[model samples]
Target: MAGQAAQIEGIVVKSTGSWYTVFDPATGQRSRCRIRGVFRLRGSRTTNPVTVGDRVKAEIGADEGDNVITEILPRTNYIIRRASNLSKESHIIAANIDTAYLVATLDRPPTSTEFIDRFLVTAEAYHIPSVILLNKMDLFAGPEFREIIDELAGTYRNAGYEVLEISAKTGMGIDELRARMQNKTSLFTGNSGVGKSTLINAIEPGLDLKTGAISDYHHKGKHTTTFSEIFPLTGGGMLIDTPGIKGFGLVDIAPDELARYFPDLFRLAPHCQYYNCTHTHEPNCAVTAAVAAGEIAGSRYVSYLKMLEDDDKDGKYRK
Candidate 1:
């Protein structure tokens, strides 16, 4: 009885399938733990039963090596996407996030608008406030690139998202970004080459997270962050860094309700003739009218249509 383990409450800071690193706020100690058997049979459909940013209760063994997570506390919110193009299961990216920062790039392994929209849709569905961080501003010096950047910023801004044009390499918008991240749990995610890790390193220099180069042949970013992990910020918040994702498939969202997640489309849906306008072909659809009127960005509309059609085999919308 003297050696019996005691239960402790902590946050799951890192997850690598079989093992989790739980960080206790009270003791500032992290314990490597495995989940109890019942967790696997809890009827949850996600690929991982326990994900980073999850608050959990675990038993700290006397030897410390046999710690077992016993319970997952209720989450305030979480971002989820289909686990794979061919799989039905979902993958919870992170839970209890205060803000979701989607780092995007115009070129050097360009992050597609569809991918951006999809990620925003998921964030909207979960009621998580999202900020679009347009990284690599230093490279967009040419007139053509500048025009593209302006249009991209305007498109999302009009759709009601805060778009920050930042150069993680040059510290252009790092201060503002850091200010926004203060005292909040933020999730930094994006396509492989969008500089999520580099940006984080710029914000918290001490982290020095590993970064990768763009594939010259494909112009895509090589995966750098292998797993999801949460880090305490020197300023006043926590950050969850995840592996670069290639495709973000919508999970648990009905086709009919997809438009609600798109802020611009949702605002115009009320003016449509039909109560349940798919915004595809409904007569007098305000969404289509807005598109034709240039009130909504064509690129965003195209992304919506693609998601509605659900035809992309790998869930990666290509130009």
Candidate 2:
């Protein structure tokens, strides 16, 4: 009977509330598993007790094949946001991600720069490398839209992030995009209608994940992917696709520590006149000066100020 209690280690590929799909690399097998009732995530106060991309250990049931997760291994890093419509709690997006790809669109469902920066700040705080994927290039062919796309790409690229211009419709820049994701575990995320699933289907054809259309009246995307799931790429890496999020609220970040998440702002902050400059109304603030000098992107500073407002009003980062 003791021998029957063998343990198997696996990576969580999908999470659906009470059930998780774990993939065992050694035997190339998959199993549906549930965690022990007493188990809790060590560090995060997440809505889900377990998240996709988590490494875990489980014991297979003898009579029924359903497994019981006995342990949730420590995560190297994870990306999270305030729980949807729940201000007091947070939701874990994905764990142990090597990189996060934030897909943005210029039209059909415009992605605000504020949204982009908030995501970037969260990625910075979690120590996850982030790449800006400017998708739907085909829609940005007009001269005016082209300028906007170019400037947006240049802004992030100058801020020390890799920005790729891709079109899931036309297959533009797909090879380059695929090359970067070859050996890394990447998490693909963005607002709904930004074509996260479409991009993945282009990168790896057979998945054929569902796609959705934007609301004509609100010009917003409808949620298509309901849960986060991880898939192994044929090219030697893994990818985590997350449900589209309407807003990315910062969690556990204070007003003072917020600037540290913005690379450009953090670099210039030490030069501020006041040691504790919030950069809001402080005299001789270097960050504000940079903004005036056009050294810092104005849109970025606006996003920062918006976050500060949220912090002041409720102490939680939310749109």
Candidate 3:
């Protein structure tokens, strides 16, 4: 007891499965910490007990090296998805985020609309504000690419999301992105090859986050950011950079409640004849009517139906 360390509060800036890097804002010091005891969330089984952006109570020993995280503070909100298509456990991408910026690309390992929808749905379920950053705008020189980007932006805009066209390689929309991220905790996530690390590096070049290249043969991005870590931005806020996710599988959301998460569909659900409409085959379904009338994007409706079917079949909705 003579050499025991007192309890101190800090933020978990990085998690590498077995150890966590806890940063104390008071002292501006980071200590390598390990879990002091078994910790688990009430109803869910999470793969990692501690994740980036989590505020925890840790003990820094007298020598100031052997730090042990004792507790994880309650999270205001977090983004979660199934750990895998076959695993029942959920993985929290980041906790207590002020904004979630999903970096998407239309070419070179294109980010599918379904994948975007899935991410938005998860954000909606968690009540987190989401912005779609269409990176690699410099590639849209031809009219064909321009049209595609325009349509994609319009689709998300019509659904009540702000879409920003950005080219990370050329600093096209980095200023606006920097302003938006100022003084807030922002999470950047997307499929591999979407340039998440590149964008972050551009936003804060001093960070010099590692960037990877796109595979020529497969047109996929090799993983560069292996673990989640939080960085202090020079612009007065924090950022949580996570590993590039290949698929986002829905977790903890029921089939009947799925529509509520899709903002476009949820707006039209009330007009349906039945109070509880799956929006699949019920007569006078407002959602179906909107889809047929071209009020809703056909691709979004397809994604919704696909999620429903997946949930109905095996309760595993992966995209």
- Scanning candidate 1 in windows of ten residues, the lowest lDDT window is 310-319
TM-score of each: 0.94, 0.93, 0.94
Query: Judged by lDDT against the true structure, how good is candidate 3?
Result: 0.87
Better of 2 and 3 by lDDT: 3
RMSD of each: 3.3, 2.8, 2.6
Cα lDDT for residue 108, model 1?
A: 90
lDDT of 3 by residue, 1-319 (tens): 6578878899999999888998999998889888754675543388876788999999878764567888889998899998554678888888889999999988877999999999999999998999999989888767878777888998899999999999999999998888878999999999988999889988888888998999999889998899999888885999888899988888877888999998898999999999988898788999999999988999999989877876776644332
Best by lDDT: 1
lDDT of 1 by residue, 158-207 (tens): 99999999999999999988888889999999998899988888888899
Range of the 10 consecutive residues with the lowest summed lDDT in candidate 2 = 310-319
User: How far off is residue 116 in model 2, in Å?
Assistant: 0.9
Per-model lDDT: 0.88, 0.85, 0.87
- Backbone clashes in model 2, listed as residue pairs: none
